[model samples]
Target: MAWYGQIEQLQTIFDELERLLPSGAQLTSFIATTVHFMDCLINNQRGNLFTNVYHNSTVRPFLLPYIPSYARLSHRKWFRYAFIHAFHYYCSFEDFEDERIYIEAIFLANGYSLDFVKYHWRQFLKRFNFSLIELTDLN
Candidate 1:
């Protein structure tokens, strides 16, 4: 395909991702979509990758300018943590809170419900295996 075709396809993928906000969002889909969006942002030219695709490269700069600045430019590590942890390939909590904050910010930025934290809080915890369920015995 041509360069313009690739750009158009990327834009379409990005737009469809926007369609999956708080209502129709699934954790797996969201992660995949974000990865695709990141690919477009970092692809300066087709297959020209001396740059850091992970966005965690101190050796190479992150290229996703479209990712909100408030999301913190140094978000790659926490994202990597979440990605790896989800697969149970690795598990650690060095800066897990920051990762949650980053994902939350992205959800809100994309017009997800403002009460996302409240509504999905349990699901989020369960997904990450950090349940916070609390109940009192009232027998």
Candidate 2:
């Protein structure tokens, strides 16, 4: 069938690429409905593509400490950017919620107050003029 031919072609390409790898390096790949790459988990579901943020299991969760005395303008800016990236990267409300909680945990671990994180989270939702429920319904 056409599907079998496509699989053969793909294997050929993978073999060629593997041959080009430098010494002591190995080709790591997955052939499945889902795969993780960088900060995103890519999925192919019934021919539909979806994505969610990926967290590596081997890496420790840590961030630069956010000391009250050392709070800089850049710190606040980075927080905003993190929220924006989560909002844009997650394809579903549930995924976004998970990322939001993970972000809060990282910030809290770094010494940010719960109130501070919640306030900015609310502002982010307000800027988009939508609640989590609305996002779920839309998706």
* Candidate No. with top TM-score: 2
Q: TM-score of predicted model 1?
A: 0.30
Best by lDDT: 2
What 10-residue stretch in candidate 1 is worst by lDDT?
130-139
The deviation in Å at residue 94 for candidate 1 is 4.1
Estimated TM-score for each candidate: 0.30, 0.64
lDDT of 2 by residue, 1-139 (tens): 0123477787787789889988788877667788887777788877777777777777788565456886464576667777788877887777787888888888888778898888888877788797867878736
Residue-level error in angstroms, candidate 1, position 77: 21
lDDT of 1 at 68: 54
Q: In lDDT terms, how accurate is model 2? A: 0.75
- Model 2 TM: 0.64
